[model samples]
Target: MDLVRHLECFVAVAEESHFGRAAARLGMAQPPLSQRIQRLERELGVRLFERTSRQVTITEAGTLLLAEAREVLARSESFLAAARRIRDGETGLLRAALTPDVSGETVAALLADFRRRHPGLELELRELSTAEQLAAFAAHELDVGLIHHPCDVTGLELGPVLHRDLGVLLPRGAVAAGLDEVPLAALTGYDLVLFPRDSAPAVYDDLLTACARGGYTPAAVRHGRGTSFVRGLVLSSGAVALGPRDTHLLAGPGDTDPDLVWRPLAGAAPAWRHSAAWPKGRGDAAVGAFTDAATHALRTTAGARFEPSARPLHLRPASEYWL
Candidate 1:
């Protein structure tokens, strides 16, 4: 007996409560439907329905099996739909977005690997503001996105992969004879290079929080919209910028600052958590691969190198706060 036919016959009998009516619904002869039901019962080794001259009703097992049978049929339908899509060669485009602070080094290596793995798949990228990433993802413009966690979007899920801590990047030549580490209090005297107040308010607000904890606010030298440019100014102007773990990445961008150095500040390490997020929808293989690549890169790049960030990068409880 055909498995699907058995399930269909069982569903019909279970619903109509009579073999003749069930056969009418199925547009088949009554004997055929009855035979299908008998075959089904024999296959399962149990009766699914009870019948008498005056009434027909489902057994306890039949009532339970009704929903399960529907679910199995739905799953099979979905599987067939997916196979048809693949056969049609219309796996479809994948849409994505990301935070600007995530560098080529952070994601490029994984993208290269993905390209080698899936050359035919076309990817659409939208370089967006953090707000744009949040809004677009919420609106279904993107298939998946990369962003820092702790964002305010109400209906999205974040899968974190990398850990990045904010650093106080001081000019190389700045002297610290007495202080072993760069204390946030000492930041008041230097010209501060920082991110734009609007572009990353969370990061900027966290900076103020660190300053308040440290007992003073630093004066600004230059502030910018781009993370790359912030590091650039810090290197050349001998000013301070909130640095991230990937600060050394500045070396490749022609940051001629021979004197650039990172000073771990005394406060909660700012969260620069990077994650791959997707809308709550069923995704295709490429989306799965993208999320996996993101996770793999985050795990590989940050697993051991970023333990210091897991805890707040605050002052060492009883030891020197600088590293």
Candidate 2:
């Protein structure tokens, strides 16, 4: 009869691909389902399905609308569920894109504890980069994201967890061995081994600015598309980099790179903010619960290693750009 009814009927028929099953799922008869589809098509002035005596297939328009309808329905239900939860104080799935970096152990423990405390809530975890993670949250594909700090992500609510300072990981006295501990300033004189620009473009750009602030132009020795690759490069090459001390997850204490040592940067070492973020204006209980869990996790686990991301400084709702 209206948009919501049309969506419900259309989605049911599409998924079942058989009018009988769809009608059954909707607790209606086949004839009503057929009528609803026809009414929806008349309203839209488009054929949404192609029908033969034996089977039914969705038209291109139907395909497009199917995804959207499903999303709308889910989100609508989420809203209803959120309202009911407000009355009953319950929660739903806590979809999250979590960045796995320094606080891996901490994140695990936090999630585990949350799950134990709130068994009714479901957490869907997707491992993604800083950009991908933020984009997912903005698109509403993810309810929340635990991402690397310092990027201007538009269209999300950001809060600080804590702060972790950056240091140069180098060979012992590697700073003396044609290297410098002053990360940004040292860029001009030594080979800069760092993550590729694609992984975190803003970070790479910021590093450039940091270097320029030191009146230096960094010379890149090697680039890693991923973390492990960069660590491999650092192990063998005579280069230095500036990042969070915990970022050296690829290397360990007993894993002695006789040449590698960590030194605090002279200027503002590229510090990272690890915080919980979500799409703006979403008041779903799932979203709220996830944010609460993540906040608690990051707060207790992050300790002094993470800080709140500066939202005023970066783009708002940065999800749209990435998506």
Candidate 3:
């Protein structure tokens, strides 16, 4: 008495126009096929076929139901196909968040490549601090995050995506003309502009440790939430900002910020690192596909290789950093 089974029986009989032929087509005995049609007719309060010793004919009611029944079956099959596609990661939505300082060139290239590989997927991207990205991932609001390195990874899977030598962005004329690299010790007396501690504590701590190794603390510190804002502060307030070597790309083309210049930091400065992270144990197919694409993009387009960290940098013993 299953409705779909009844409809199938009805459709097969309606198309074949003979119970014996319908049963042969359905690979069933003719008796059961006849009984199913009778049950369907009784339920609908209409006879669906006219049977004679010489021939069989479909009733008007059977013809109408045949069209509706075929549509239902077709739609059911389409639904299953769509479900399979989603399971296979052939089509879906991916939401990703990233830290503001993540390189624009890297992100754009990665996105373009991923889109080419997964034309059916819809990508939603947002910029957030490392802390915000972590929170969003935990809340299940985000599928992936691009964050600064040395982050806490207690309940997440993370791998490095990019590494670049650190540099200092100083106000124009802050140092003697033509100085290519500024020694860290020379920055001891200068006020520094940096990201807030809570936004990326590990990166903030790394900066502090780097300065401490130079034999002095900064004279003063100013907090900013984004690299652009920090750079602006450096330009107007004469405070130096520490960032990646490619930080100049953040500047608008042809907008001469003659007030700002980038100088590499001397003496083995800690590298600016970025990582891609996702929730631990998440088995979403789209997330898996995206991770694979991101891994490839990082290796090829970004020219960075992922080296798995056995333990997060902050979790390591102090001796590790000292050595």
Candidate 4:
């Protein structure tokens, strides 16, 4: 028997105190309503009603069960409503990550926007590189990630790609920094300061390829995972790091590394592409919200732009360079 249905019939009959009236109120035939009550009574081993040709009355057992039945029905409704809320992503935990190279301002803007758009969602954000995010996705430990492109994304779905033209971050006193814009061949002898290759191998290799194509191959490539560390290398080691024009924002407030300057390459030689990624077939409203917020933050705060004719995303070989 459908227990809830039987309970409804029982309650209706008890309240109406007449089989014909109860059946009409339930929008069912009197015989079926009576049969359902009989089945419920058989399953519970109790007679729920005292009936006669003249009148029908709820028995003591029915009277005691009526309140409990109503409570169960209310709880069922509450359970379904809660399930729907979660399905709609109205209230739940969303595990999200961002690449470390994203500027602080962009991260802050994304957080503020996501919170504003989805006040009920609890966001657990983490700083992870492209490779680390891929691992997290594989392990099912992450929900969504703002990841750098030109990396492996075989099993993931991507959001719209945003592009940021890269410039060289060099010591302010360097001769090349004196120029309004730095040409690729101008700093031939300097080493390159870049993030560890393992952090994002494809992007790392593709960047090196682009530099070589522009006639600016470095003497050596030095790895620095943090902005301050990259700046230190550029200052003390005579190396230059590639970054967006707003790379100074990575520094703390009132602590913009005055010794370092970002100069655009003559042709925007190398650009960084980014997009939101999640496992295929796993997107939900929370993920979509994060993706939208990330795109907006990257464009506004990170000075990123979307290409009108963006190419398909895939792992490009290090032998080829892309703009």
Best by TM-score: 4
Per-residue lDDT over 1-323 for candidate 3, one digit per residue giving the tens place of the 0 to 100 score = 69777888888888888888889999999999989989988999998899999878988887777789899878877888888988776777889876776566767777887788788888888988888998898788998877777777778876545666677877667762247778877776678887787887767777777777866477778998566678778767757778765455336432255666677777877676676788887646666656666666556654554543443445433221231
Task: Judge candidate 2 against the unseen true structure and give its global Cα lDDT, from 0 to 1.
Answer: 0.67
Candidates, ranked, TM-score: 4, 3, 2, 1
TM-score of each: 0.59, 0.59, 0.82, 0.87
**Residue 59 lDDT (model 1):** 91
Q: For each candidate in turn, give its C-alpha RMSD to the true structure in angstroms.
A: 12.5, 13.9, 3.7, 2.9
lDDT of 2 by residue, 34-92 (tens): 99999999988989899999999999989988888999889888888777864543555
Winner by TM-score between candidate 3 and candidate 2: 3
| Residue 103 in candidate 1, Cα distance off native in Å | 2.0
Q: Pick the candidate with the highest lDDT.
A: 4
Per-residue lDDT of 1-323 in model 4, one digit per residue for the tens? 78888888988998999999999999999999999999999999998999999999899999999999898888888888878878987768999999988877888999999999899889999999999999999999999998887888989999998889998888778899888888888879999988888888888888888888788889999998876678778889989889887566234332255777777899747788999999998888889999999999999987899855666678865542444
- Model 1: lDDT equals 0.65
- Identify the runs in model 2 with alpha carbons over 4 angstroms from their true place: 1-91, 149-152, 176-183, 186-188, 254-259, 283-285, 292-311, 315-323
Model 2 residue 159 CA deviation (Å) reads: 2.6
All candidates in order of lDDT, best leading: 4, 3, 2, 1
lDDT of 1 at 13: 83
Counted clashes in each candidate structure:
4, 19, 1, 0
- Local distance difference test values of all predictions, in order: 0.65, 0.67, 0.73, 0.86
